[model samples]
Target: MAFTNEQIAVLEGAIASGILTVRYADRTVTYQSLKEMRITLRQMRGEMAAQVPGRPRARRTIRLYQSGSGNV
Candidate 1:
């Protein structure tokens, strides 16, 4: 699920307090580990970046260049 900035803040707070449980309004989430929480935070940040206005999303690119010599 995509998390909002508020949700991300809550997660960060929990991590800062060394807590595994995060509360958001009426819902509460208990994470399995710090690794899980960190992963969630990273994902949330990435999502936030993707939602920025006029920002370019990651794209695939290809470039053709000459190698050493034509001999193989």
Candidate 2:
């Protein structure tokens, strides 16, 4: 479904205000992160790229090192 200009304005407003929440057709969407918001915006604008499945999500790796390792 295509979004109207008013809806676009609301989305833009939410982005600008850093709210990241939108109410659409009696449904509320609280974006998890900026990435999710952008994806939703793209979809609302009829962009197919964001609609594709298997889109790799950003991943962060952390190193866990033990000092003076002991079998405990």
Top candidate, metric TM-score: 1
Per-residue lDDT of candidate 1, residues 27-57 (tens digit):
9889999999999899999999988999999
On lDDT, the leading prediction is 1
Compose the digit string of candidate 2's lDDT tens values, residues 4-72.
666767787888888978886688888898788877776676533335578755468999888785777
Model 2 alpha-carbon drift over 4 Å, by segment: 47-72
Clashes of 1: 0
**How many clashes show up in model 2?**
0
Error of 2 at 70 (Å): 51
TM-score of 2: 0.51
Which pairs of residues clash in candidate 2, taking residues 3 or more apart in a chain or in different chains? Answer: none
